[model samples]
Target: MINLSIEEVLKYERGEVCNEEDCKQMTLERSQSNIFMAVVLRENNKLIGHIYFNQTVPFEFLTWEIGYIFNQRYYGNGYATEASRRVLQYGFEELKAHRIIAMCNPENASSWRLLERLLMRKEGQPIWHNANQYAILADEWQRNNE
Candidate 1:
């Protein structure tokens, strides 16, 4: 529900926000999706990080692919993981998303680790994107109490 400035979004796009451009494109695509959100972190009102998702059909079933990024200065602080966990809860428990997935470059050990920490199963190998390919899918998320 946070308002992210276009400048802030662009900063992410240019890789100043995260070391990865896939992270930036995810933010841009989320802004376009309208169904998605880019939650930003602020300190003294300065934008510092973001988390977002998009609905995609990587399998026969509809699913939402979640993504996130935190400023390099903010790394090791658990911001990205915490935000991702909350967003996954929102997507599953509130939005009623049938499945949620996240893709990351195989070299992005931190991101892959985050997904694993969330208990998202590695669904498959790399898939193509913007002239590059990477690991895809986590799994369908099921809210136990539901």
Candidate 2:
């Protein structure tokens, strides 16, 4: 199988690969949010992939949404999981978010499974993007980690 690389992911994010400028702009706009937080890794100080969180639309008061992307070369190495967990902890413990949610394309099995492994409950199909939503509450998170 062909692997997706971080360079590819970044190109997609920057609207260079996918021809979807909206996605690149959305990421840029969301990055400006005060509540945004990220978990990143590097080799010899060179940046790698990142898992990040930001306030979800219309629920920006307390709930948040998360997103992540890693180099396809890092697939199956647990790097995404490890970094995501740290960001989740930061979202709840540091940011005091009451809830955190994530959504992924339905066809992406690995993406959904990662949310499940993080103890997020499947909330069924979302209204847009043909993606599935998963969420976890702060109390639920605390209980699981405790």
Say which candidate scores most in TM-score: 2
Q: Which residue pairs come into collision in candidate 1? A: 126-134
Q: Which stretches of candidate 2 lie over 4 Å from their true place?
A: 1-43, 59-61
Q: Please, what are the lDDT tens digits per residue for candidate 2 over residues 15-132?
A: 2333346545644664576544333445554334555577776766688888887757677878778888888998899989999998777777888889998999999986856778
Best by lDDT: 2
Worst 10 residues of 2 by lDDT: 1-10
Off by over 4 Å in 1: 1-45, 58-60, 127-146
- Residue-level lDDT tens digits of model 1 in 1-146: 12232334343232433334555565577668765555455556444566667677564565787777565666677877778888888777776777787766665677778887776767666555421122223333453324
Residue 17 CA displacement from its true place in model 2, Å: 1.3
Can you give the lDDT of residue 63 in candidate 2? 89
